[model samples]
Target: MKIKKKKRTSLLYQTNVEYGDWCLNHIENCAHGCKYPCYAMMMAKRFGRIKSYDEWINPILVENSLEILDKEIPKYKDKINFVHLCFTTDPFMYKYPEVVELTLKIIKKLNENDIKITALTKGVLPEILKNFSPENEYGVTLVSLTEHFKTNYEPYAAPFEERLKSLKHLHEAGFRTWVSIEPYPTPNIDPENKIDALLDIVSFADKIVFGRMNYNPEINNFKDARRFFEECSQKVIKFCEQNNKEHHIKFGTRYFDNKNTQTLFNKK
Candidate 1:
């Protein structure tokens, strides 16, 4: 039997996360394509196929996606509470104006049916998000503030300051904003100063998700990275408690023991 291609909206199963029930990718590739040895790229490299992530993962418009959505929504509408945009690529990439417009249109249709829409991006442009509604949640991915680290690891993403500025703009526009601090490499460095800076920018955010580096032998691993990550998590949680901010630390099986971290956070 030949498998039918899904129409306008691609069908995503689900994850344990609270954000969305369905995930859709408007594009196939990521422009930034971090050099710090991402797991996704590692798999692609081992296959000896694509030279760079952009060759395979950068944004590709799915011509049939929108029409597919119009048909699928009626059948699975009850199963979806939220629709997440572009899990594999940034929806706000500089070259995706047409894709962005179609995404906004699809989101509007979803909203009419009571499903929420959320997006996570590196935030290269603030104007791209002008149409997002208050019910839509926006997440900005941030790894480091130091320019040298950012240049080496994330050459294609916008500068740290510009991304923060985009976050601030979304917050001021009345949209729910969040931050994803994943792949925290230089974890031992004191985040007290950095946390202070982030807090100033994301004061309007409803919550934050803290994550550490994924297990990858090829990537440069700092000796004290885990210790620093925990220290930063502690500081962030304490700061959030004092200032009434909500935060969660995500520790997958590869990085740290989940039971120990859970116990540590559970203590009063």
Candidate 2:
């Protein structure tokens, strides 16, 4: 899909999150190419914004993104509840060197204008994230610790160890750091005990956002996924509680509301 370069009247795009007000997607289509197979890619294809795997592999940098943002940020600056960076794309995607530069520029500009920003990525953590500001919140998605899961899924992204190190770096730098295990590749990455492997890095994170894998049933090994994920969520809850970490159990992964248990039986 081509980059939507046309200048917009607004860059503070509104969306839902845990008290999140607006978001910005300076780039579209992540170069990470998570083949779990990426749900974002699936949605983009469903809507005809992206039509092929080859196109998904090649990311597009939104043209005049910062210029458009400059025009829009002032309008929503007062009402902003910490704008999130690039939900449709990785704000720190390093596969495209230009995106790395753009991300840094955007963050720096927003910080200068006192517009709080939060971002999560499987990509690099540039030097700019070390700021002492209370407004900057940075996060990384460390879904699994195994190299196999990463190579098979997020092939073009940074190595798992590097990603963890970046998260730790930001956390220790006194920046508000968070982690996402969303679409937490549970039984998909480890058919044996996915939650244990998933929570191995919980201590490094200040906040954790996790949810069940959706729309990738073909790759999972859970016999009764809904029940399994509910159990997994329980484990995550316990782990986070014991460690005194803030955690969010995203929708569809909640046991109380899971509605796919018609033939549910544990085969694990």
Candidate 3:
């Protein structure tokens, strides 16, 4: 893949997600080439940032990210709680040393300002990150353990075991670690997979986030999609409770019965 560079006027902004963290996307496009209807790609194309999936797989690094960040830090530092290393792109994108180097510098700069960071990636986390602030949290996205599923959907992202190894390394080193099982496929995409198995594999994480796949009509093709996600969310809550692991179930994944005035599972 050809690595390209671009300049941006600014590099930091606050995110309005429920978690309410500031976010920075130092790269445009992603090498992971996720096919779970990558929302980032969709948005990028919609905005004319890129024209096609073929172009999307070759990432464009923000050449002046560090320079831009230096200027913005002091202005937003006080108002910022923590900055997510990316909402629209992966920081530790696999096989892209340029992306990783820039991410390291970005993290160091943020830490120097006493700002924490939260990052989630499908790529392998580098070990050098262990030397950074332990307060910063690192996470990986693992929705299924099967190679068949990964090869078909995630394509260019690191293998599941490789991603898990890096996450577990960070966790065992006393750094905060988490996992995101998001845009998780239903039977239509992963027919023989089980959520519990993936959960068990990442049981070492300090927190687990579960959410259903969206956008892709194929997932909706599953007749029991609603119940499937509801039951999966309940199972995730139960597992987290029993293992003493923190958990977050994205809003739509949890179902409520207003007519009965009861919830099948307690919200976490």
Candidate 4:
């Protein structure tokens, strides 16, 4: 797809699965090339009928997106409570620094206009957090602390320890930090203990979002997935509540039921 600026359909769009106030995609493709099935992957499978992730995730720059965003912001100035950066692609992807720079420039413009911006990614760079204002939220995506699991699933992205370090750095820098435990994998051993350690690093974050693994027919043995997700959610939510930290449960058709999911989504 060609990269150019254009008016987005909605200045404020609902997050499909993950937790956040609203979402925006500053770029067209993601760089991480995550091994697990993601929203983008699912879409690619639906339309292109493409089997492999590599064939679909050719990261492209959306040059026109920023200009379109600049014009679109004013239209929903009153209703847009928070703006999420790049829902489909990781803004901090190694291949799109220039595009990410432009994206951040637009975010700064929105901030100047009194709009709040939040971002979620697995490829966060420390320098990016330095430029973010207090109103900007920074969320890091995590699933397991085991080096092997991270290497196998999120290979192209930063290491697990590096991500934790980045989260701590962002928190210390005073940016509102959050953690995303989505696409939780089913492992031979229970990872609840590992999650506690990961949460310890993110304890300073303002909030945490927990989402279950997406159900892709190609992936098998998903029977235990929902149970594990609920367990993880209960553990994290309880921990957050005990520690006086904010947390939310994200739901989708593949995992938790819609009615039960709303309990957290309805919150402010």
lDDT winner between candidates 2 and 3: 3
- For 97-158, candidate 1 gives per-residue lDDT tens digits of 66556667767777777767777777454565657555777777786776776766777776
The best candidate by TM-score is 3
Judged by whole-model lDDT over C-alpha atoms, candidate 1 comes out at: 0.62
> For model 3, how does the per-residue alpha-carbon lDDT over 1-268 read when each residue is reduced to its tens digit?
4599999999898877644468899999999999988999999999998899999999999999989988999898888878888889899997999999999999999988888888889999999999997778888999998878888889999999899999999999998788999978898789888998888889999988888999898976899888999999999999999999888887677676223312211221
Clashes of each: 13, 0, 0, 3
Q: Cα RMSD (Å) between model 3 and the true structure?
A: 4.2
What TM-score, to 2 decimals, does candidate 2 have? 0.87
Give a tens-digit lDDT track for model 2, residues 90-154: 88876666888878888888878877778888987876668634568888887777667777777
Quantify all predictions' global Cα lDDT against the true fold.
0.62, 0.72, 0.86, 0.67
Better of 2 and 4 by lDDT: 2
What TM-score would each prediction reach against the true structure? 0.78, 0.87, 0.94, 0.81
lDDT of 1 at 179: 80
Give the residue spans of candidate 1 off by over 4 A: 1-9, 16-20, 43-51, 125-131, 187-196, 216-221, 253-268
What are the RMSDs of all candidates, in order? 6.2, 6.7, 4.2, 4.0
Which pairs of residues collide in candidate 2? none
**Candidate 1 local Cα displacement, residue 35, angstroms:** 2.5
